[model samples]
Target: MARAVAWRLAAGLIFGISTAASAAAESFDCVIDPAIVVKVGSQVPGLLDSVIINRGDRVTAGEAIATLSSKVESATVALMTVQAGSTSEIEAQRARLDLAQNKLARVEELVKRNISAKSDLDAAIAEAEVVKRELALAEMRKRAAELELNRAQAVLEQKTIRSPITGVVIQRSLSKGEYLDQDKQLATIAQLDPLFVESFLPVSKFGSIKVGMPAMVKPNEPIAGTYEGTVKVVDSVFDAASSTFGVRVELSNAGQKLPAGHRCRVSFDGTTD
Candidate 1:
């Protein structure tokens, strides 16, 4: 009985040591990739006037990256602007209304003095009402012109393509003078500031890793440094065949010193690769 007790104690000590060793070697293979890749395109079809950005150029969100041929659109905007700003028609109608009102007042006075026929007074009143309607019609036309100007400006704005994300341009598919369609891609951009480190962990680590946990990522030799990252995602579904679950870590690359598309290793226990 004494010998059996000693054997069980030794085996327990061996199992505890093995578990500690496995926990210490928790680093896993991972790959550094861009957080998002976008294919930039124009909203309207036109001939490309110019491409403001080239491959490898960093762009900010809402920055104009490309422009399409907009000569006709520009002219339309200018014409609409002039029409909207013109007050000649409105002023002429107001003048005509004033003359008609003065004629009606004189005719009313003549009728009161018994010098003019009632039919003459009625004619003057009808003329004044017609002029008032013409003035209103002119005012309505002016409002319509203003709305048309806004529509023309909006159509012109669609000719300029802007970047939806702040990132580096990776590819330029269309060049100046090329025909661009709404369905065609003009360029490719990748967001790298907040890089993603993707890795798969054994099923045993399912409950051990959680979102918001801190991690250390070390890229392969060419990039020699360790980056601190935070656990962004942990898969709830396991890969039955591999008995592994995927994890995503977000690493900040403020200056973008690190390039993406490299293999790396990550550890959650504050260890280096």
Candidate 2:
């Protein structure tokens, strides 16, 4: 597989010194290559609650692929949410503050009319200030509770694994109810759309192909589609043995109608850079 991928890469970067081939409507052997393949894994470890994806499944970016046991985390999140949602603590503090303010107001009027002493007004003012400070403290606690709830929710999200790319699931390494260790791989995914059509041309034609030039790709037996592709690479280095330059073509594979690894032939028109 690695050699095949390297050969495909060479198709785009072929460099040669010979009076090679023409850039006309000529054909060269090629192979379909996947643009990207990834082995998806998890960041944390836990018992696998479920594996929702299997081989041959089509997944979108950010789709939930699997999940770990999150019962405890869910319960914690719920508890934190309730605590964060509760406003009784702040409400009680606010009530006390209001009462203090009313007492201060009454004491001030009474003192002004000589019905109360200055010490009573002073005491009432102190009580109001204390209640105001208590209210501020209560508000801070509420904010702290809310922040904790957010943290719990974030942890819960991590317990559920999501796909990082939109692609096809080619292989799955895990099953539901299995113990998934930390950083364990769960599945392999591959992006096939806009598949790479890599091919090599004679060294002499090295200077003829230009990026963005249109070409035709003909897949071998079993794959009967003739796909249109664009020149994406033209290498300037020569392979010691083949003495040929490499050229790469990119073609659209919408709906994955064409499969990778199939042998193909690519044709380019008599257009040079």
Candidate 3:
């Protein structure tokens, strides 16, 4: 009887331990977020000629937003071309070549008749050759001028600024006719449509999360309903600073209702629970 009682007590203890462990292993909820703010700036510099879009305006990729006044730059390009076409040096060389050719023809005729000495004919031929070289050099100078004109035209084109990515204009720093430098931050753009909702995954959940997994986001603010997204990226390396790996979920906000930098909860279906 004593042995049986002892065995029963041990079995009850094991059952209680198993039940506690199962309760501890139950799934729970986690709030998702890796919020980031984006900025915008121009790659080149000039006077701000136009500001087409205002703050809070949504923009598409490769859309033109602002531009620098290119009138003066365009005129400079035209002037350089004119200078190349009508330079005095080129005209002078052409005239010299024409005179040398005429003189050489006359000398050759006299030499055939033996009226002009051979040495004189040779000297005239040498003068013609020198003139020909000068004409070639003049042509080379024109080619260089043409190259300069092309470069000037390219710079003039760069004055017009365009949006780098599809996003919304968050801020505008300059107005029309404002001077800007190459490194200046002209505006700020945040991708709202299909914006990325960054979140953290604990080390324990690393094996469960994978690319293409479905996710649901609930913004803290008044969004219409739960936003759907997919796991776009999973960090290969752990973030030592946070003791969590990073995961990115892409959600669309075509209506511009989901504002960037909003805190949100991300729920993974079936996989997490």
lDDT of each: 0.94, 0.86, 0.77
Ranking the candidates on lDDT from highest down gives 1, 2, 3
- C-alpha positional error of residue 86 in candidate 1 after TM-score superposition, expressed in Å: 1.0
Q: In terms of lDDT, which candidate is strongest?
A: 1
What TM-score should be assigned to candidate 1?
0.83
* Segments of candidate 1 deviating more than 4 angstroms: 1-25, 105-121
Higher-TM-score candidate among 1 and 3? Answer: 1
- Each model's Cα RMSD: 4.1, 11.1, 7.0
Give per-residue lDDT, candidate 3, residue 22: 61
- Error in Å for residue 200 of model 2: 3.5
TM-scores for all candidates: the values are 0.83, 0.82, 0.65
Regions of candidate 2 where Cα sits further than 4 Å from its true position: 1-23, 233-246, 270-273
Each candidate's clash count: 0, 12, 1
Model 2 C-alpha lDDT versus the unseen true structure: 0.86
lDDT of 2 by residue, 178-251 (tens): 88887678999988887888888788777778999988888888777577889988887988798888888998
